[model samples]
Target: MGDTDGAEKLLEEAFYNQPFNKDIVTLVFSFYMDTADYRKLIKVAQRCMAFHLADRLCWHRLGTAHFYIGEYQSAVLAFRRSLEIEHNPKASFGLSQPLLALGLYEEGFNRFEERFVANPSINWIRAEKMHMPKWQGEPLAGKSILIWSEQGLGDSIQFSRLLAVLSAQGALVDLILHPHHSDLEGVLSTVAGINSIILIAGNRFKLQRRYDYHCPMMSLMGILKLTPAIEVANEAYISTPASHKNKWFEYQERPEKKIGIVWSTALSDAFLKEHPMHAAAKVKKSIALRQLEPLFHLSHCCFFPLQIAISEEDRQYLSKYDNICDVSEKLSTFSDTAAMIDEMDLVISIDTSVAHLAGAMGKETINLLGYVSDWRWQQNREDTPWYASMSLYQQTFEGNWEQPVNKLVRLLQ
Candidate 1:
């Protein structure tokens, strides 16, 4: 294999010789994109764009590179440029996130429809939704509406706040998410206006019967024409079952404050392989369990792992730490985890379901965010209206958790 430096030199020579060649620019784009070299990508992308101004791919590349570097405004322009060139669902989906991140919710939600067309997991669901009368902005008095979840648990939880709006309007709300979330049915039933909760795989014909309208859970925002002026109805949403209130821990009570820690997300290999960019972004969202060794040394705190389970590597690593406790054996459901989080003095989490769960439950949560995080986290803000009890600790540069970790140490001290 050629050394990276030499390979770069050869690519540069080729680009210099055939500056206008689409193939050469594409190669250059791939080289930088795979390497996560956003700055060089920006330079190469701009060079290509100036020559091939009409190229939608170049504009898309430019937008993604800008997005990676946390330049929301520039990313918006570049994605829009790509869209203006052609009707690219990829570009439209790309445009939506940064638009929302920049706090342009109305425009962002308008373009967000393209996600269902561009993303593999969501695209198929759209066809199923089309069989039902899609909810438009209409009066919901005495009407029954179905809201089906599209994404991960965290996404469902984040958007579930909007259900209260439906509740206020005298609409009967029913939910249909994945079958695996049946454990959380007890939890979802607690939401203000929800009449029933069914797993997508369970009682489908019965659940789908005679609805006035049905909507993708995320589309509720767009349907509501959600904007900054419209305050999101966030009152009395998710809560844990009262039966799970009893705390169970091996160690006896100590003066040390109990902290729940979730450092990473659990994702399927197939999903990661299918969405490489999402996989890369997911990589940025987590802290290596090894990287959290310093926090484990805090004698004043006894840490508990709230993630579904620890990896074998992390499990072995935990053998060396006494303050951090393993209690995953008791956590069999989201409801179980919610009960435990209710007992904690605080919860520290990365961009994972636990973060959303803790935030939704109104627990004191310190959410750790990467430089470029989920659109919901947005950019440059310590507080989110989505969760009143959550405080954000964001990385100053991509993949560097040192500054945020140091700040967290101070906060805990």
Candidate 2:
């Protein structure tokens, strides 16, 4: 059915004949990585490593395979072995995830920064080529700094705590965004002590205020040796505008538990085009609206849609269920979304920005995690240090939402 009919067979034959050959094994590894067949990769890698114990690339791929499949300890072992062979950026980057998942943030945060060198397509690296002076441990008082968001909207919102601490130190901090991220300005602009918010799309008008320092928002954690905390320094840093909160005041008839639901991730098309595998991963994380019919049947819990850019199929699915209100249309900005979250008695979301937003606001939230969630969620724990108001529900089985959904239903009951 596809153009590469004979390729898989030829590669399989080559790999079978020359199992310990680095070049052949690498080609096979790339084939599996492209296909996202991690289990098969593990088998092949383990066999390769049995003979070629010193192969760092083989150990790295083995560790990555274990990481993808939720075996954090095994991954840690493999990654450590790879690092022992050679202190490469790819091994360091691969090692960081499992360590963070295991709640060892200090080392994880330090090593995670190597991802830029391991995979250079990161947007932050592109920003650095323009010669933005990074802030080390310099004095913040009476200094002006520009902190820009690195990865996704969720990450920007989650790590905005650093901005608050900088402001508290009287650094005269300002938040900067990419040109396309102007919509986020509405949410971040309201955070206390931000001097100004600028969107740098080669706009000379916005760049009029010269900054003394420029740093990626996520980098502050490593640079400052900070860990994720909710109560002490990082308590509810995101501020919802009173006006925006007032707009959602009309929906506050909470006789039953008012629950807001987010089933899909809202990623930019540009980002999706750049990372096709992540676009595919979106399907793994998203739950079909129809599949959540059981949750809708719960009469005591009123559900509201927290997702923007609703797909036609999801829209049709929403139409079939009267309980799932289509309030997503009213959420023009993240501030509106934040205010809407304030109205909810409980928020249930798959790991997305809405979940992070709810957590940032200190709203009671249930985060539905995949079998192996992002390192931020950590592992084997219901509670996260990043969000005291949030509780995690992890999938016991891979590629299945039934377990987490059932848990939510039980929690609602």
Candidate 3:
């Protein structure tokens, strides 16, 4: 039997007995990274760096740990140290995130291409194999361009605003989306400039129509020379169908104010294990149902759970509150979710697709973020450039939701 507990115990004993053993230290560090124990990874990485200060691998690991904990400056320094030892593509790519988060767009976007080089399996990398010419910031007056989706659903929703800008420039835009986003086909089709929405599934991608030029959706930032000034000024572009909008109103009794809540994320343990870098943010972004009990105490405010899938524990927790309604079963599609959000007075959620959907819908949203949030949220800000109606409430420190939750309670009161 493959016993993880037994293996962990044996590793601990080996580390204790041979504290200075490089093999043991490396193994322990790998274990922590695999398990998503970032706190322990930081401690172990620091110890490894102390013993092997000049080792590029140690510096890279230390940088990664610092990056996870929101220590951007420290991470930058550590990655720089690793680069000094050797020109590492992964370290160079790792350096781009914090720089981008700090609003160093030019430098960050310049180095952002390293992501495709580092992660060979990324969608953009596959898109590169199509042998199509990438569309730069050139005149597209008579050109047909393919804008393929990359990363998560939230990313696609956030960047979809740029499609309108491209369309206004007289370019025929073809959008290639993931199959999971099929629900958005009807909603996105309504966008002025989109010529087609092709969903990638099985071997269906090979049969897609051609375009004059192609670009990844994220590349639009660099291509259009997006700055905070331009981004913040952008308004909500997503629209809801009349049928879907009416369905939401018909399904529910009108409350004084409908507040939507998403306490957790959809990122599975398997996905986190594969992409350890996102693990820390994922952990910090999700809050337990009990932690949000403070908000539930507010009177005259009806809370609706916007999550598509609810764990049994959360289901039981939700059942205890009359004011908190579970509408997960009814939310079969992203359009349905958008419709419910359109009906909401406010959307209070942790970092999730719901937040993006609500923000894109121009809903008054209070987005609760972790101490170290994704690059899009930026740092030390109460409002985001991505959504004008959305207000951000970030954690003052790691693993402390009390402060943000208290701030939210006061806002609600």
Measured with C-alpha atoms, the lDDT of residue 316 in candidate 2 is: 84
TM-scores of the candidates in the order shown: 0.90, 0.90, 0.90
lDDT against the true structure, each candidate? 0.80, 0.80, 0.80
Q: Which run of 10 residues does model 2 get worst, by summed lDDT?
A: 200-209
Error of 2 at 69 (Å): 1.4
**Across residues 286-318, which tens digit of lDDT does each residue of candidate 2 receive?**
777766787988988789999887888888878
In model 3, which regions exceed 4 Å deviation?
Answer: 1-22, 251-253, 269-281
Candidate 2: segments with Cα more than 4 A from true spot: 1-10, 20-22, 123-132, 202-206, 229-234, 254-256, 267-276
lDDT of 1 by residue, 169-220 (tens): 9898888776655566766766767788866564334444678888888888
Model 1 clash pairs? none
